[model samples]
Target: MTLNAAPRGLYFDDFEIGQEIVTSARTITLTDIVNFACLSGDFNEVHTNFEYCKTTAAGEPIAHGPLVYAVAAGLQYATGVNDGTLLALLQIDGWKMLSSVKHGDTIRLHSRVLEKKESSKGDRGVVTFLRQIIKHDGTTAQEMTAKYLYRRRPKA
Candidate 1:
């Protein structure tokens, strides 16, 4: 069996509380919505059926809540803050979808490290981050606090 080497990335000690990081923007598209619907089995009319959406309050198809959340999470990773140093996602707290994400809306994640603590064994640490998914127009589409466990750097 081949040994899996640890990926080089920021360790638990590298993070500073209150440090903010922004990610590259991505535009929501019909294909992305459709793909997310297929993958998640969430074929909601507001996200898939344009005709049905016309009769709704939004009057247009909106992206799925989970889709937006997933995208925001991906954007956070794209920022290279955690990278391969992430051990596991511990929890998600106070996740709120503040506004609808519609097709053609470019969005990005703005995240701040909220808290950090070492594990009992000191082999890893947990980091709590406050993340906001903001649209190009400056509207906050979603906000959440996510906790992740990151590995500590190995001692030489």
Candidate 2:
């Protein structure tokens, strides 16, 4: 799905339960894996070593789960409402790593808004969603349920 280029802050009125937001695709390259390994200090052989993978059940080098999650979260942020309107990401629950992502895999994230409610103490409301990270070929790699605090629309 093509995202809006115009910056529109997501307000309480913008989200509806059961609405799905599809994020842009991002491809993971070898350089991305190596760079992520250096930045995150995760030097696990399963992610960085093809030789080690030959002995493991994965049978080949794989991307780190967190790295894949970061890509997915980036997509979620680019959806416009979360980055422009969010005060904070309050909670993330039920995050499951389902499949292995190898190098050169292009992935996409899809988010379904599950609930919305006004916060009692804050000027914002809470938006919660179930997010799915899918491979370019349509395999689901990971999923998460996350909640964020988003600003309410200003009084006109």
Whose lDDT is greatest here?
1
- Which pairs, if any, clash in model 2? none
Candidate 1 per-residue C-alpha lDDT over 1-156 given as tens digits, one digit per residue, 9 for 90 to 100:
999876756899888999888999999998999999999998878888989999998889899999988888788777777778999999999989899999999999998899999999989999899989999999999998989999998898
All candidates' TM-scores? 0.91, 0.90
Residue pairs in clash, model 1? none
Q: Could you give the C-alpha RMSD of every candidate to the true structure, in order shown?
A: 2.2, 4.6
How many residue-pair clashes does candidate 1 contain? 0
In model 2, how large is the Cα lDDT of residue 153?
74
Q: What's the lDDT for candidate 2?
A: 0.86
Positional deviation of residue 113's Cα in model 1 after best superposition, in angstroms: 0.7
Worst 10 residues of 1 by lDDT: 75-84
- Candidate 2 wrong stretches, greater than 4 Å: 1-7
Pick by TM-score: which candidate is best? Answer: 1
